[model samples]
Target: MSVLVRTEGRETAAGAIRPQAGLSTASRVAAVTVLTSLPVFLPGAANGLICAELGWSPVRMGAVLAVYWLASLSGAFVSRRAALPPVVERTLSIALFATCLGLLTAAVAPAVGLWISSAVGGYAYGYTQPHTNALLMRRCAPRLRAFAFGLKQAAVPTATLLASVAMPMLAGAGGWRLVFAGTAVLCGAGGVFLVRQGMRHGIRPGHSGARHPAATRDRGAPLRVGTFLVALSCAGFFGAMVGNGLGGFLVLALTTRGVSLSAAGAVATAGAALNIAVRLAMGWLVGRVPQVAWAALTGLFLTGAAGTALLTRPGLGAITVGALLAYGGGWGWAGLLHYAIALPYAGQEQRATAYSQMGVSLGAATGPLMCGLLFQLGPDAAWWALTAAGSAAGACVLVARGHVGPRPDAGVSPARRRPRDSPRPA
Candidate 1:
C-alpha cells in the first residue's frame, strides 16, 4: 500500500508566505489601523447624540452598545475557521459591512433598526481585527512584528481624532444622521480600494500551506493554559477597562471636577492623540524592552493617574494633561505588551482564535459593565477599581514571567521547527 503524507512548510506555486514587498510594513499597518479606527471613533459620540434625540434612556443606549460588543464577541469565534485570506480581505469585508450598516441606520432612523445595524457593523469590525494580527504575524518578518503591532494600535487614536474632527462638522451641518451616512460612504470607498489592492497583489482567503497540522493542533491546548493565556487575559481586561469603561466617563469626571464641558472634551481628545503618539513610540520600544517591563511600567502609570485623581487637586490644565498622558501611554503600553507576547505562542494555525480571545474578554460588554457598577458606588470607586485592575494586570505579567523563560526557539524561522520538535509548555 502506498500512503501520501503532507509535508509542512511547502508553499503553493505562488511562493513562500511573506508580506508583499510593494505593501511595505508601514502601509500594511496603516491600512489595518485605518480600517479598525473608523468604527471605534464614531460610535460613542454618534450613539450619545442618537439617544438624546430619540429620548432614549441610559438603559436603551447601554443596550445598543452592549449588543455591539456581543456581536463582536460572536464574530471573534467565527473568524477562527472562516478561512480569512489576508489582511486586505478582512479589512474590506469589515468596511463593507460597517458602511452598509451605517448608511442603513442613517436612512432608517428608527431606534430598533439602528441598534440591529450597529450590532452587525460591530461584529464585522471585530472579525477584521484578528485577521489583521494574523497577517502581521505570518506575513511580516519577526523583527518587524512589535513595531507593526504598535503601528496598528496607533490607528485607534488616529481614527478617534478623525472622528472628533468630522463628527461635529457633520452633525452641525446636517444632523447626526448625516454623520452616519458620511461615514458609510467613506468606509465603503475605502473598502473597495482595499479589495482592489488585494486583488492586484493576488492575496485571497485560505492557508498558503506554510503551517503544519500537527503543530497547529498542539497550539490549541497550551494556548488555552500556561502563562500566555494569563498574561493575555489580564492585558485584555486592563486595556478594555480603561479604553471602554473609564474612557466613557472621563469627560463627565472632568466636568465634575469643575472643568467646563468643552475643555473636558478637548482634554480627552488630547489624551487620545497622545495615545496614538505613544503607540508608535511603544512599538519601537517593545523590541528593546521586555514585555514584563512594559506591563510594569503601564501599571505604574495607571497607578499614578489614579493617584493624581485621588491624592491631588491640581488645576484643570495640569490635571487634564497629566491624566491624558498617563492613561494614554498606559493603555498604549499594555496593548503593545499584549500583542508582542501573545502573538508568538499562537503559532500560525490558531492565530485568529488566540487574538480573538483578547477581544472577547476586552469587548465593551464585560469590562464596562464591571466598571459601571463600580462607578455607581461613586467616582472614587471607579478610580479605585481602575487602579486595582491595573495593579493586578501588572502583577500577572510579573508572575507569568517567573514561570515562562524566553522561548529558546524565539526569532527562529517558523519553517525551521520540525512538527514533532515544537516546544510545548510543561
Candidate 2:
C-alpha cells in the first residue's frame, strides 16, 4: 500500500496524490471553527447567564455541560477511520446545521428540553475536530501544520471573546435564550457558507501529489506505537481539562471571590484575549523555539497549574494576573499537544487525531463536573483541584515525550523531518 499525504497548498512529483492548488483553506477553517463553537459556546462563555436564567446552581450547570461533552465521546471514537473530503464536508455542514437547531432549542426550550438540546448538540460537536483535522492534515504542509492548527483553534477564543463581550449586553434581554439563539444563527450561517464552498471546490483525490509512505488505508498499527500514542492522548485529556475547566468556571470563580458580575465578564474576556494571542503566536513560535514538543507540552501544563494555584491569592490585582496566566498558559497547550499527537502517527492523521480528540473530549466533558464538585469547597480549593489536574497532565506529557523517537520506515521524509537542535512543538 502507498502512504497518505499532506498536500495542502502544493503538489508532489507526478503519479503521487492529486494537487489541491485551488482549494482555499479559509472556507474549511471557518467551517470547522464555527461548528466547534456551537456546542461549546454557551458552556464556555455563558455559564453565568445559563445559571442565572435557569436558576440552577453552578454544579447543576456543570452537570448539563458534562453530559453534552459525554455525548460527543461517541463521535470522537468513530473518527478513527476518517472519510473522503466531500464526505467530511457534507457531514460537517449537516451536523453543524443540526447543532444550530439544537442551540435554538436550548435557547427557547424549558429546563428538560435544554438538556436534550445539549445532548443533541454534543453529538455534532464531536464531528468538528476530527473531520477538521483530517482536512487540515490533507491541506497543510508539514512545516506549517502547527500554525495551521493554531489558526483553526484561534476560533475557540474568538467565540469566547464574542460571547464574553456580549454577556452583559444580552443578559436580561430575553435571558440566556437570546444569547443561545444567536449562537444557533451563527453556526447555521457558517454551515451554509461552507457547503456552498464545497460544491464549488470539490474533493478530488486522484489529483493528490506526494503521499506519506506510512499514511495508508490500513487501520492497524504496531502495538508499541499505539501504546506510546496513548500517552499523548492522555496529555490531550489534561489539556482539555485546562481549557474546558477554566473556560467553564473562570467567571464564577472570580465572582465568588468578590468581583462584580460585569467585572468577572471583563476578566474572562481579557483572559480569552490572552489565550487567543498565545495560541496564534505559539504556532509561529514553535519554529523559532528550540524546545522539543513534549517538553513544551509539559511546561505549558505546569504554567497552567501555577496560574490556577495563583488564583488562591486575594485582591483584584492577583485575580487579573492569574486570569492571564491561566488562560494564556493553561489553555495555550491545546494546539501544541494536538500537533504532538499527529507526529508519532505521522501518516495516519485521522486516526492519530481521533485518539487525541477522544482524550480532549473526555477531559472537557468531565473536567467541569470535577471542578464543580471542588467549587462547592470554594474557589481556592477548586483552583487547587485544577492545579492537581494540570500537574497530572504535565506528567503525561513527560511520559509521552519519551516515546517520540525515530520511525525511519514511516514518518515524514528525511528532508522534511530534517533535524535541528530541537523538533517543532507547537
Candidate 3:
C-alpha cells in the first residue's frame, strides 16, 4: 500500500508524461488491444436484432444505454482509490463474467430478460475501461504511448469488422441466441487470456510507483477548469453523437436516399476502414503538432462533413466518398486528441473521474437517442441536426482555445509520474 516516488530521468514536454523504460511495452499493448476490443464487437451488430425482439422503443433503448454509461462512471470512480490493483482485477473478471452471462440470457430469455442482460453487460464493460487505460499508460514507455494507444483503439474497428461478417452468418444459421452465445464464448476466452497473460508475466495489479508522494507533491498543479471542461464536453458530445450513434445509422440513411444496401454497406465499411487508418495517423500527428490545433482541425473537418451531408444531393458518389473521408478523419482524430489533451488537465489522481464525468455530462446515451428521434422526423432533418451539432462543437473548441491560450509547456503532471527504478515487466 506504500506509494514510492522515484524522479530519476523523468521529463515532461507538451503536457504528456514520458514513461521510463523497463516494461514489456509491446506485450502490454497487444494485451490491451485484444481485451478491450472483444466486448465492442457484439453490440454493434446485435443491437438491432435484440431491440426488435425485445420490442424496445428508441427512448427505452436510450435509457438502457444511459444505465450502462452510469455503471461505467461508477467504475471510474472506484478506480480512483489508491488500492486499485485487486479492485481492477476483480472488476475485470466480474465484467467479463457478466457480459458472458448477459449474452447467454439474451439468447434464451424474453424481452425483459434481454434488457436486464444488456444492462448488466454494459455496466461490466464500463467498469473495465478506465483500469485498462490506466494500466496501459502507466506501464508503457512515454515515447510509445500515443502509438500504443492508437494500436489499442484500432482493436475496436477490427473487432467490428469481424463481427459484421461473423454475426450475420451465425444469426442466419443458428438464430440470434446462437450469435449471443458465440459472442459470450469469445468474451470469456478473451478474459481468460488477459488473466493468464498478467499472471504469467508477473505483472502485479496495483499502482506501479506511478502514484508516489514526491511525484504527487511535485505535480499537484491546478488545471484550467472552464476551458478544458468545455472543450472536453464538446469533444465527448460530438464523439458519441456521430461516431457511436450516427455512424451506426448512416447506412440506413443512405439506403433511404436511394442508395443500394450494398452501396450503403460499402460507405459504412469505408468509413470504418478510414477510421482505423486515421486513428493511427492522428496518434502520430499528436506527437508532432499542437494538440489544440489538432482539435480545431478535427472540428473543422467534422463540421464540413456534416455540412456536405446536409447540403448535397444524394446520388453523387464523389461527394459521398469525400464526406466519409471527412467524417472518418474528424472522428478518428478528435477522439485521440481529446483523450491526450484532457489527461494533462485532470492530473493523474482524477483522470479516470474526469473521463467518467465527461461521459455522463455529455449524455453519451442521449446523443444517439436524439439522433434516432431525428431520423423519425425526416432524414434531412437528421442530417441538418448533426451538421448543426458539429458546428456547435467546432465553435466551442475555438472559444475554449481563446480562453485557455496556448500550452507551450504542457507535459505530464508529476503527481502521475512513473517510477524510474522499477524493472520492466517481461
The most accurate candidate by lDDT is: 2
Off by over 4 Å in 1: 1-29, 81-91, 203-224, 288-318, 349-363, 406-426
Q: How good is model 2 by TM-score?
A: 0.82
Candidate 1 residue lDDT tens string, 1-426: 000112234323223434343136545556545644454446566766777788887667666666667766676666655544423454544556564665557446656656756577667756666666655554455445566667776776676677778777778888777766676776676666666655555423463755544345554443334454455456565656655665667777778777899988888787777777777766666545544344544454465345434413457756765566445644666446545444544444334234534454354576567656766776667766666665565565555444444454332122322222225544
Question: Could you estimate the TM-score for every candidate?
Answer: 0.78, 0.82, 0.75
TM-score of model 3 (CA atoms): 0.75
Q: How do all the candidates rank in terms of TM-score, highest first?
A: 2, 1, 3
Runs of candidate 2 with Cα error greater than 4 angstroms are: 1-27, 43-57, 82-87, 170-178, 203-225, 288-292, 406-426
- The best candidate by TM-score is 2
lDDT, residue 9, candidate 3: 20
lDDT of 2 by residue, 1-426 (tens): 001223232434323423242124623564466555656566545676667767878667667778777777777777665553434566677776888888887777747756776787777767557666666555555545566667777777776666656766785686667877777887788778757756665546575644434444223542233545677788778778877888878888888777898898788878888887887777666634424454566787888888888888998988888878888888888777766665444445566677787888899877777777788878777788888888888888766555555553322221233122222333
Report residue 31 deviation for candidate 3 (angstroms): 6.2
Candidate 3 per-residue lDDT over residues 1-426, each given as its tens digit: 111112212324423544443134433444434433444445556667767877766566556555555555555445444233532344455566677777677667746545666567655554555554554444445445555556556665666677787778888787777877777776677667656644554334453633433224435333234554556456556655555555546777777777788887877787778777766666555545534343544554465446336434556475476457545644564435434443443234234334534453244565566668787987667666666666655665555444443344433322222222211122
Show where candidate 3 strays beyond 4 Å: 1-44, 47-83, 86-91, 197-226, 288-312, 342-353, 360-363, 400-426
Model 2: worst 10 consecutive residues (lDDT sum): 413-422
